[model samples]
Every structure is written in structure tokens, then in C-alpha cells.
Target: YADALRVAQEAAEALPIEKDAIVGANFLLGLAQIEAHTGQSKEVVKTLRQLLTIPAGEYVSLTRLKIDPVWDPIRNDPGFQKLLSEPEPETVYR
Candidate 1:
């Protein structure tokens, strides 16, 4: 778990911001999932929060967050629970 976490973190950091936001966001999401699986509640919350700030973050599926088993460890955490409860933003199609 530790090694996987380190690799994910490194990948996220190594990814060029000018390339693709989605790729970076996905890496961050993978890091957060590993954190959650390893019982790093604080780190999971922090990573997920950071992910929310990225432009590609909007593309994250709230449904996946709610049902994914990888997030089970943090499922009961207040911050994680709050994130789950928050309503998804409505998309405005032009």
C-alpha cells in the first residue's frame, strides 16, 4: 500500500499541468483511493478536497464515489460523509 501510494503521488506530481487536467485528476483520485484503503482518512480527505479544486474534478462521478469499495475505509469519516452528501452541481448545457 505504501509503495502504491508513493507511486501514485509521484505520478500525480510528475504529470505536467499543461498536458491534461483529467489525467492529473485521475492520478489524484487514485492516490486518494489508496489513502482511503490504507486508513489514511486525513490524507484521503485532503487529496479528495484538492481534487475538487481541479478543473477536471467536475467530471468525477459522484455515483462512483458513493459506491466504490475502495472508499469504504473513509466511508464513516465526517469529511468524507459530508463530501458524499453534497449535491452535485447542475450542468448547464447551452
Candidate 2:
């Protein structure tokens, strides 16, 4: 578990922000999942919060987040629960 977290974190960091924002954000999400699975609640929330700042982060599906089994460890966490409760942003089309 620790090794998985380390590898995911390193892969996320090594990704180029400007050229691989989407992929990097996804990697960060993977890191967060690993943290969650390992019982690192605070780290999971912090990592997820950082991922939310990336533009591609908006593409993450709230419904998917709610149902994903990988997040089960942190499912009852207040911070993680709060993140699930926040309304997904509305998209406006021209």
C-alpha cells in the first residue's frame, strides 16, 4: 500500500502540468484513491483537494466518486463526505 502510494505520487508529480494536465490530474486522483484505500483520510482529502484545482478536474463525475469502491475507506470521513455533498458545477452551452 505504501509503495503504491509512493509510485502514484511520483508519477503524478513527474507528469508535466502544462502538457499533461488532464493525465496528471487523473494520476493525482489515483493517488488519492490509494491514500483512501490505505486509511490515510487526511492525505486523501488533501490530495483530492489539490486535484480539484486542475481544469481537467472538473470532468470528474460526482456520481462516480460516490459509488467507486476505492473510496470506501474514507466513505464516512466528514471531509470526504462534504466533498461528495457539494453540487456539481452547472455547464452552460451557447
Candidate 3:
């Protein structure tokens, strides 16, 4: 998990913005999304919660969380279902 966060941090440095933008949000959200796909629901939930603190988000990006081939692990989880029904912060962009 620590390594995951480090990778996310490094990824942000290589991208277009600083700590509070969508690109940075991607690194964290991507990690969480991947973990969720691989049955890492606890980490996924934790990571997404962290991302929601951002003004906008990188999860649900492309609105893909609902249809993405990844996230199959939690595809049927009640929490994920609830999340889908709730409005995403970036619906306009996604």
C-alpha cells in the first residue's frame, strides 16, 4: 500500500498539475480502481474516499466505473452500487 501511494505520488509529479487537480487524482483513483478489480475492496473504498476530498475526482472518470472491464471484483458490492447512484463530482467532464 505504501508503495502504491509512492507510485501515485511519482505519477503526479510527471503529470500536468499539482496536488489538487484531476491528473493527480487519476494516480490515486487508478490505484484504487485496480485494487478493486483484484479484490482489494477495502483499499479501493479507502482510496476513493480520499479522492472525494478533491474538488473533483478521477475515479468514475469517463464514468467508466460502471462499465469498465476492471472493477469486476466489486461490481456487485452494495457500496459500489450506491456510489453509482450518487452523483459524481465530475459528471460534466466524464
Top candidate by TM-score: 2
Which portions of model 1 show Cα errors greater than 4 Å?
A: 16-18, 53-59, 89-94
Model 2 lDDT tens row, 49-80: 66555564354556767887778889999988
Worst 10 residues of 1 by lDDT: 52-61
On TM-score, the stronger of 1 and 2 is 2
User: Candidate 3, residues 1-94: lDDT per residue as tens digits?
Assistant: 5676557556755762354466667776667765775666666766665565555533454266677767778988777776767765543322
| Angstrom error at residue 79, model 1 | 1.6
lDDT of 1: 0.74
Give TM-scores for every candidate, taking all chains together and pairing residue i with residue i.
Answer: 0.73, 0.75, 0.54
Compared with the true structure, all predictions reach lDDT values of 0.74, 0.75, 0.63
Task: Write model 1 residue lDDT over 1-94, tens digit each, in one string.
Answer: 8899899889878884446666877887888888888888888887776665556434455677788777888899988898878875453322
The reply for model 2, stretches above 4 Å from the true place, is: 53-59, 89-94
Error of 1 at 48 (Å): 1.8
- Report the error of model 3 at residue 28, Å: 0.3
Q: Which segments of model 3 are wrong by more than 4 Å?
A: 1-23, 49-59, 90-94
